[model samples]
Target: MPEKKQKKRPGGMDLDQKAYQGIRQMLFFNEILPGQKIKYQDLADKIGVSITPVIHALKRLEFKNVVSHAPNRGYFVNETSLKEITEIYDTRLLLEVSLVPEIIRHLDAESMDRLGKAFDAYREAVKEENYYNRLMTDMRFHLTIASMAQCQIQLKILQELFDTLLLKYTRNLILLGIMDSSLDEHVHIVKSLTDRDMDGLRQALSTHLDHVRNHITDGFRKMFAVKPRQMVDLFSLQ
Candidate 1:
C-alpha cells in the first residue's frame, strides 16, 4: 500500500517565513537601519502580510539576537558597535582557522570544483561592480569551505556571524578602494586550499580576516567622527 501524503499548512507558516526573510533583508541592507524601532503594523504593511506573521517573524529574529523587544516599546534592530565587531571577528578567526586543517584533510575534487566555481563567480561579480552580489559570492566561497569541515556547530556560528557582519564590512572595504585586494587575498586562500598546504591556507585566511577587521575598525572610526549625531539619534529612530 502506498503511504498517504500529509497536507501542508497554507499561507500561515509560509507567510511567517516570508515575513522573516523580508525583515531580515531589510536589516541586512540597512533599509530598516540599526537601532531603529520597527512597528508590527509597518512591517506587515511593507511585507504585505498580516500582523500575526510579522510578530512571529520578529520573535524569531529576537531569538537570533537580530532584533530586540521591549515591555512597552516595539522591536528594534540590534545595534552594531565596535566592541561587538571586535568580538565577532575574534570568534570568527578562532573557529575559521581551526577548521582549516579539517577542511583541507576532507577536501575532495568535488569540493575543489565547487570552491573554484564560487570564486570565479565572485571575480565576475566584482568586475561587474555588483558589490552585493560579489559579497554574497565571496561568502559562498568561505561557507563552502566551512561545509567541508563537517562541524555543524561551528558552521552555524560562522554563518550567523557572517550574516551580521558581511554587508557592513564589505561596503566599508569597497569604500576604502581595497575590495580588489581582498579578492586577491581570497585567490591566495583558494590556491592554498587547492594545494593542500594547511600552513599556507591558515596564513592566507588570517591575513584576509585581519585586513577585514582593520578596515571595519577604521570605517567605524571615520563614520562616527563624521556623523556623531547619527549615533545619538539611534534610539530616536522609530
Candidate 2:
C-alpha cells in the first residue's frame, strides 16, 4: 500500500461515500488488482474511516458489479468476463455511433472547444506514467462527444457501460498492450466532427471502437488460453 495520509470527509457526504471514493481511487490506480482480496480494516485505516463505512461502501460497489464476495472469504476486486465485456463493447459501439449524428447537429464553438480540451487531456494523460489517468482521459474523450448529442437515456446507458469497463476490466489492460493509436484516432474523430463530415465521423468512431474491441478480445483469449486445470485454479482465486 502506498503511504496515504488520512483523508478528511468531503462536505455533505457521509462516511460511506467518503470510503467509497477512497476505495475507488485505489482501485483505479491499481493499488489493488482484479481478483485481489480486499481488506476492510486496511481500507478503513487508509481512508481514515471506520470499518463499518468501508463495508457499506463495498456493498454498494457490489451492486455496481465492481467487486465480488465469496462465502467465508471476503470481497475481491472484480474479475473480467469475456461475455460481459463483449456485451458492453457491442452496446457502446452502437450507442456512440448512433450519437454521432446528434453531435454533428449540435456542433458549435462551445462543443468544439470542449472536444479540443478532451483531446488535449487525453494526450497529456497518455504522456503521464499512470495507466489509470490515461484510461480516464480516454473515457472523457468519448463521453464528451456523446454528451453533445443530448440523448439523456442513451447517454446514461453509455456512462454505465463505461463505468463497468473502467472499474471491472482495467486492471488487466496491460494484457492488451499500449493503445497508443487511440490518440491519433481521437484526432481523426475531432477533425471529422470539426469539419461536420458525418460519414467521416461515423467511420472514425466505428474504426476506433472496433480496434479496441479487437484488442480486448485478443487479450481475453490470451487469458483463457491456459490449460483447463490451470484456468480453473485461476478463477478459483477470484
Candidate 3:
C-alpha cells in the first residue's frame, strides 16, 4: 500500500492580515524598490504563495497608494514622493496635537511613568545605534499616549501614519541621521502630559513635527544630490 501523504497546513495568518503582513514586510525590507514594476503572478511566486493572496495584498497597497496600476502596464511601486511625505507628516501633526487635551485627561501617574520607561528604552536604542529598535520604541511611546485618548479611530489612523513613515525613513537622510534627538522630544511631551500642560503639549508636538519635516527634507535633498532620480516630488509633477 502506498503511504498516505500529509496535507499541507494553512499559513498562520488570517487572509486579510496575511495580505497586510506580506506587503508590509516587502515594503519594510526594501525588497520592493521604488519605481519597480509589480507583476501579480511574479509576486506570488516570489512570496511562495498563490496568486489569490498576492492580488489581495496588491489591492490593499493600492488603497494606500503605495502601488498604482497604469493602463496596460500592470502595477508599479509608488515612489516616496516629497508631497506625499509632507502631507503625511502634516496630517500626523494635526491629529497628534488635537489629541493632547484628551490624552491629558486620561493619563495618570502610573501611565506617565510607563511612558518614561519607554522613552528610556528609546534612548538606549539610539545610543547603541540599533536603528530599527529605536524607531519601534519611539513609536511605542507615542502610541502609549495615543491610547490614553480612548479614540479607536485615531489610534488606527496613527498606526497607518507610523507604518508609512517607517517604510519611507529607511532611505538615507542627513537631518534624521545626524540629529537623533527624538528621545529628548519624547521627554518634553511626557513632561507636559504629566503636568497637564496643554500649551506645552501643543508646543512640544509642533516642535517635534517641525523637526521631523526638516529632517525628511534634508535627508531627501542629500540623497538626491548623490543620485538625482532617487527623490520624487509628486506635487511638482501635478
Judged by TM-score, which candidate is best?
1
- The CA lDDT at 220 in model 2 is 83
* lDDT by residue (tens digit), candidate 1, 1-238: 9995432246445777888888877766667866778888888899888898889888987877777898788888776677877788788778889999889889999988888898999889988887678768877888888888989999999998887775234443344434448888988999898789999999998998888777767776766676657744642442
lDDT per residue for candidate 2 within 1-238, as digits (tens), equals 9995554465767787899989888876668777789999899999999998899899999998989889999999877788888888888898899998899998899988998899998888878855667877888989899999989999899988887776777656644635768879888999899899999999999999999888887778888787869855754553
> What is candidate 3's lDDT per residue for 1-238, written digit by digit as tens?
9995522338556554565577678877777778889777776766666777777778778887778889888878887677777787788888988888888888787777877788788788878977667667877887888887888899899999887776655543212444557768877887788788989989998898789777877666665565445344521231
In candidate 2, the residue pairs with backbone N, CA or C atoms under 3 Å apart (3 or more residues apart, or in different chains) clash, namely none
For every candidate, C-alpha RMSD to the true structure in Å: 5.2, 6.7, 6.5
For model 1, what is the alpha-carbon lDDT of residue 1?
94
Q: Rate the local accuracy (lDDT) of all candidates.
A: 0.77, 0.84, 0.73
Off by over 4 Å in 2: 1-10, 126-130, 174-177, 226-238
Q: Give residue 183's lDDT in candidate 1 (0 to 100).
A: 81
Tell me model 3's lDDT, rounded to 2 decimals: 0.73
| lDDT agreement of model 2 with the native | 0.84
TM-score of each: 0.84, 0.82, 0.82
Error of 2 at 35 (Å): 2.5
Residue 134, model 2, lDDT: 80
Selected candidate, larger lDDT, 1 vs 3: 1
